[model samples]
Target: MTANSLELNPVATIQSPFKSRFGIPRQSGLVPDAIGWIEPHAPWHRAEAWAGIEQYTHLWLIWQVHDRPHQPVSSVRPPRLGGNARLGVFATRSPARPNPLGLSLVRLLAMEHQAGQVRIRVGGLDLLDGTPIIDIKPHIAFTDCPPNSHSGFAQNEPERLRVDWSMLPHDEALRLNDHQRLVITQTLSLDPRPAFHDDPERVYGCPLFEFDVQFRVENGTLFVLGLNPFP
Candidate 1:
């Protein structure tokens, strides 16, 4: 048997508030307030390259799930299924695939065209900070959304956990700006804890933006413990 392989270079990189792998909404748009910036590499960073891109409201991002292990696999346990059942790798959006590539559809918020570079601000991203973006394309609804689509076992989104900020101080919560607060609230509502574990007493910490957002879960409720500066 013969083998063929191809190489690809990252076209851009993203700057996201998801400082670590923990707590990123499992799926894009789950946290509409979660934001990120995409900047092209040297050859393509020129403003002229991004001409007319602002007209579109959404985009498709093809990137590398750079932080996770991607050893070849035939099946993966989906978190949405409580990680109990195994599904073929092709059927799941797990990063542990042969290629470790990720595809996301995100909303484009704004575009900044500087003298030499183009900065694109996008929202509803579910990726790690500094993720390598392999490709970017405008999402054309007419072609991207096919008629009568079926989502299989992942048809509907998982139920969100109710976030309780009572455990956190009013002054501490007040310190965060509107966008920051929204990001924290929306991110925690997705319940980023490991799907296999449901220990109510377990304390978890997620590094979001400039602070360490810590919390716990109990009875379908998520309680924010505190927000400490990143040391």
Candidate 2:
């Protein structure tokens, strides 16, 4: 088939909590709690076919790079090195590419139909809100899970940032469930930032709900001053 004939139009779009790409996790599986929904176009809304999809733990999402504005290229600068180092586009998960496609393996929560419209509730999405979706596929553990995967050039486990959760108010701490609490703690601990941008004096902020969490890491621990819920 010719290139023009192989072009695939989006069948759906994802509505996610992620309004901006700034704070999204570099990888999807890293944030299993983040939720989103997929709304399929009119032509493909057959509720019966998607029935029992909640029985599965995860689903594979084939989505388009709606946020990518530049032309696709064969090489890119990975964020890991503060975008100073160049690597083959295929080696890194850069959004800019020939196809501008994104593949994410996310947890399926539920499916809802309204007015003949089918929506899929999912978790651990890295895409921004209204991201165009090309297709959906089931994630088979037996076939998709590769136990002996190698990292190749992406070796060297990065060090985690330290966080002091004890400083949080009792009421605020109690508001989060065990899973949310753990995820929040773990995510902050990773200190997801450019490797070369680490500076002791630098402070970072992450918007959570109505608050902006300002923190810094020192001595392998993250220190939280207080919460500033954004307006």
Top TM-score hit: 1
| Pairs in clash, predicted candidate 2 | 162-221, 162-222, 163-222, 210-229, 211-229, 212-228
Q: Against the unseen true structure, what C-alpha lDDT does each candidate score?
A: 0.90, 0.74
What is candidate 2's lDDT per residue for 89-181, written digit by digit as tens? Answer: 989888887887889999988888877567889988777778998988899998898888786555555456767987777776666677655
TM-score of 1: 0.95
What is the TM-score of candidate 2?
Answer: 0.77
Candidate 1 shows a clash count of 0
lDDT of 2 at 71: 92
**Where does candidate 1 clash, by residue pair?**
none
Distance (Å) between predicted and true CA of 152, model 2?
2.0
TM-score to native of every candidate shown:
0.95, 0.77
**What is the model-wide C-alpha lDDT for candidate 1?**
0.90
